[model samples]
Target: MEYFELNDGNKMPAVGFGTYKLTDPEETPNTVDAAISAGYRLIDTARVYTNEALVGKGIKQNGIPRDQLFVTSKVWISDNGYDKTKQAIDSSLEKLQLDYLDLYLIHQPYGDNYGSWRAMEEAQAAGKIKSLGVSNFPDYQITDLAQFNKVKPAINQIEINPWNQEKATVDYLKSYGIQPEAWAPFAQGYDHIFTNPTLSQIAESHGKGVGQVMLRWLFQRGIVSIAKSAKPARIKENVDVFDFNLSDDEMKQISELDRKEGVSADHTDPKTVLRLSKYTTNLNGLD
Candidate 1:
């Protein structure tokens, strides 16, 4: 698998296995184990996912040396502020059962992020985390954030897929020397992208499945993409993307399939933000 060079001069795998919408604790451990055994070195999870301990267990069971694996987790808004963030980092460690995190992200742009960033900076300095970043943060938020912090974010995990390329946002992130990563890359299989005439033609030409074509497209664009699945066979299949390459024509045509403004939720709407914030709370242990 290819890796993206971070601003701090470290290389991160361009493709990772994500655990989103996966709340079953029992399923998480085995799913993670299957992915690691199948050659996935990058595993992305978050406190909100409520499966960090299971992810850690899977890694330990695989007996893969800690250095060989890249584990990422996010701090929730409820854990914002300096002291709170510091506490949250330690809590994440307990959940993941790790000595240090490869990457720790501030889960959202809300709450006392200024304090949160400061705490993240401290965590890096103390070697509790190798790198730090944010998820779901827009350009303005990043701009507002940089004014106080000494460390720039290493990566920004956002929504990027064939339908919602968000080139403008991608360009803005690049300008800050921050790598843009994709979360819901397949749009949760919501659209006809799987069988679109253009995508199908591209897939046929390359002798790859439509999923492979989409993955290849994201990788060719230099974005770190986290694709998730509970099925073991599918877990292995998702990472077998290094063998194929998307052509310039195919890439360009696919890039044009952009649906300019399509975040998974209406991030601009206060109601949407309020609704998502609810996930930050205890979630009644249901999540």
Candidate 2:
């Protein structure tokens, strides 16, 4: 349950419970409830996830005080203009059954992001969104937006795992006082991540699983991470990373695992950008 102070002087949990693919309408609420019960204070959801209402139900069911819980949602690429992004925020609040969000992010960089960022700035000033950030934004996008925006991005959510460490991007964002948040912190268990000898050896030494080692490495590197799991046991295990430390040698061994490429989609591709722009499915159904 470690925390990091954002550039705006707010505290964000270093480890968060991610709700990326918790699509089952029934499973979403149950899993979110389990995560909250397992000591998760940060709940990350997105409009594209289409499970905000379920996540809200879980929070309401848990009965955790609103101020004690940190809820985050994002503005989808389809809702990219200033007016649309602002409307999207209110829609998210209504769906999540909350008055304000702890954090709100521009879900992608390929949009009228400058316009969207302006809306986010207005929302923060109006107190509807406490903090602001972006997801899948590379180094240049942050610089381009931050240079002219009223409020700089507080964080950048990107895919960060051993195979795609994004060290350079993280360092660049840090220089602008932006915190780097790891989305797929375990590479989604691709390439036999759990059975990797280097990670397994380190996990063995610490009596932890490979997932725990990956999360610990992110924490030690000062990156915020979100790990997703529908099972309560695995959800609990993701948070049990603070009990041990990774030695410098062990850390280096893990650091050397970076391939500096995304395990999933490539946001840098123009085709990806064009594809996202056409993805106007109206995830929130507010349009």
Q: Pick the candidate with the highest lDDT.
A: 2
lDDT of 2 at 191: 91
Candidate 1 colliding pairs: none
Off by over 4 Å in 1: 284-287
lDDT for each of the candidates? 0.84, 0.89
Residue lDDT tens for model 2, 1-287:
78999999999998999998787888888899899999899999988788889999999988999988889999888889899998999999999999999999988888799889888888889889999999888788888898887888899999999999988888888888999999989898889998999999999989899999999999999999999999888999999999999999998998899887777778888988776777663444211
lDDT at 72, model 2: 93
- Per-model TM-score, in order, reads 0.95, 0.97
> What residue runs in model 2 are displaced by over 4 Å at the alpha carbon?
281-287
- Report how far off residue 146 is in candidate 2 (Å): 0.6
